[model samples]
Target: MAKSKVYFTNLRASFGRNLLQKLEKLIKEAGIGNIDFQNKYAAIKIHFGEPGNLAFLRPNYAKVVADVVKELGGKPFLTDCNTLYVGRRKNALDHLDTAYENGFSPFSTGCHVLIGDGLKGTDETLVPIDGDYVKEAKIGAAIMDADVFISLTHFKGHEATGFGGCLKNIGMGCGSRAGKMEMHSSGKPHVNQQLCVGCGSCQKDCAHSAITITDRKASIDHSKCVGCGRCIGRCPVDAVEAASDEANDILNCKIAEYTWAVVKDRPCFHISLVVDVSPNCDCHSENDLPIVPDVGMFASFDPIALDQACADAVNAQPSVPGSILDERERCHHDHFTDTHPDTNWESCLEHGVKLGLGTREYELITIQ
Candidate 1:
């Protein structure tokens, strides 16, 4: 297939053209206006950042996207699925609180912030892809309900995926609890005995009789558990947890399939800012120093290509001194791989191409 166009702009800006202005110019030049967003609900998939994580993109960036959507006569809202982990973003209430705390209020970003899944992480839409690994994808209901989808990602390093780019932002970030469980784990979730208070919420919510309360402690029967991940969302105390045991390559493949399920049959666009460049996901409560210096912004209609371009951009830069990549052995000579040697970021893009998502081959069109 032919190469996709990935538009880019450097961080250098004059008083006449700020970074936000550059972002607006970049996406418009990259063909965001091609999508007919007239009076439609455009869901801007983004990570509001787990509370205390300063590596996430600031609300200013989100406003630029939201403003562009509104200028095109679309109703836009910033959104993210509640994280599966026991953090400030595990539930809708707490998620909103964290979002507002992190400067994502409507007053600031000029758009509402919606937790994609409902109060718990169980509100999902079952999208059937039937890929090699995932039979169906459970995506956040709010995300799938939108008329148009756009990913505004903070391109950064991840412990699992090597780097979390457009594909990871839309795929794993949009998955409901069960969808995330399928991507991250091969086995079912188990109860944390210490955290479990015998509330029976999980037992009551489980469609299968997999959980039992005994001696004020809860345990999961692996044989009986279907891995629906409902219990993980329903647990009042956040005791039920999914294991992160999936291989990196397999995890990347699953993430690609999940991404296919989300953007398929919709008008989707992507934009990733290659700043911060943290060594871990924004889901982590704390972030290490950036492994690479700030690159700039990249946007594309093809998410797979967008991701590939972002990875290439990161690898092209020299590793930052006094950062994690500097401290690691550079056997791979690739920034992402050197930072997280075990991760294979290419698998996601390759599998995405196999699924006819988009080609990894891209021509970077510098917008400056």
Candidate 2:
């Protein structure tokens, strides 16, 4: 197989040029213009960052991608699916508000914002993947509706999957609310008796009628629960939680499969910014100190290769003082594994490669 090519450009900029100018140059080098974007609906999949997270890609970067798509006559929109966890982005309305509050408004990015899942996060299209762990993936409707897909990822650490890269961004980030539930757990949510308010919110939102309120507490009939995860967001007190961490790993594997469902037939391009290197996922509203110095920006036609390259780059750099890595006596040689010892990021990439999503091997081309 031909090795995928990953292009890179460091943060250094000439007085006449800025990072945005360099981003455009990098995209052209990656051949993103080859896609037939004329008169097509282009979806620039991105994380707008939870309101307090400072590590997310700046809106200026999104503008560069949006502008390129529009110049190709494509109707570009910045998009991301609703979250499964109980947070500000749990639904479309609140998700949009969070996006705008973070400066990702249509006015800023030269495009509109559409929560991939609809009003309730259940608005999705089931895509069959025939994978080992997942047969079908529930993807957000708006994401599946687009003619083209582009990922703008903020490369960072993840507690479960080792690292958050292009695949994590597309696979985990693109799942609809129900799909996210499928990706994060093995079973339906369980009500913390102590936290349940007996408000019947879970029962009201459950389409399966699996939840019941009695004695001022919520109980779930596991057999009747479809594991839809709707109740996770509906609980007023955040009483509902997934089965366990084992289930979260299963959820991660399923997320990889779901990501395959999204990018399988699309002309895709990926860009990962290796700056603001947080120790946790961008899903967190608050970001911490970076673990390493700003490296550079990378673009690739292969998602897996791009991710692997980014991880390798981070691993090669010396750890930052007073950061998460500094707290440990011995630095972990593997970037993702060092941060998330239990997570095996390679598994996700290997599965992605086996699924023909992209290659793990690539030729890293430095643009600077």
Candidate 3:
């Protein structure tokens, strides 16, 4: 395969053009205009920053994307699936509230915010992929419904997948509750007795009657549990711990397969902002100091090459002083691996290539 073109622009703004203008220019130069967006529903996938985390992409950036989509004659909306953990965005209601609270309001972004998985994180579209890891990918129904898919990612580190880039935003970000359960775990979930408050929320939400509360503790009967991941979202105290036994490499492969399910039958575009550069995913309520200085913005029609280019750009930068990457042993020589020794982010990009998502080799086209 030929090297895909990945367009880039450093974050340097002047009187004539600002960062938002630069972003609009970057995507257009990257060939976003090539996609026919006329009279189509475009889903602009993004993370709305866990309430207290300041590292998420600002609403202004989303507005730029939305405005561009509208100028192309498409209806655009900001979207993301409910997270699979106990947080502000675990359900649609809470998710929207958090989005509004964290500067992702429709008024702010010039587009409506739609929680991808719907009310309870159960609305999904099952797409058959039949990969080595996943047989079928369960993506959020609303995300799959869009005529065009665009990822506006805040490139950053993650404890599980090393760095959360375009593929991570689309794959794991698009998965519904059960979908996320499929990718993260290989077995039935269990309860964390220590965190159980016996609220009966899980028991009431379980469709298979698999959870029972006794002596102020909830227990799961794995035989009856279908692993729908409903309890994990419903539990008020986060006692229903997901069984995340899948190896990181398998997890990455599953993520790639899930991404394939999302973008396969649609016109897709990707943009990643290497700003804030947090040490973990924006899912965390709080963000740590950036491991590296703000790199800039990247855009590509090829998600795999987009991710690869972003990773390479980040690796080329010098580490920030008094940050996690700086404090780590730095033995891996690769910033991502040095910061997250247990994670191999390349697994996702490699699997993406095998799945025909895009090539890792990219021609970096730097623009003003």
Question: Pairs clashing in candidate 1?
Answer: none
lDDT of 3 by residue, 322-358 (tens): 9999988988878989989999999999999999999
The residue-by-residue lDDT of candidate 1 on 1-368, one tens digit each, is 99999999999999798999999999999988999999999999999998779999999999999999999999999999988788999889999999999999999999999999888888999999989999989999999999999999999999999999999999999999888999999888998898889989989987778888999888999999989888988888889999878999999999999999999998999999999999999999998899999999999999998998898889999989999999988999788888888998998999999999999899999999
Error (Å) of candidate 3 at residue 100 is 0.8
- C-alpha lDDT score of every prediction, in listed order: 0.93, 0.86, 0.93
Candidate 2 shows a clash count of 2
In model 2, what is the error at residue 93, expressed in angstroms?
Answer: 1.6
lDDT of 2 at 300: 93
Residue 246 CA error for candidate 2 (Å)? 2.8
The per-residue C-alpha lDDT of model 3 at residue 110 equals: 91
Model 3, position 297: C-alpha lDDT score: 97
lDDT of 2 at 352: 80
Order of models, best lDDT first:
1, 3, 2
Worst 10 residues of 2 by lDDT: 244-253
Please give the distance, in angstroms, between residue 134's alpha carbon in candidate 3 and its true position after superposition.
Answer: 0.8
Candidate 1's displacement at residue 31, Å, is 1.0
Distance from true position, residue 101, model 2, in Å? 1.1
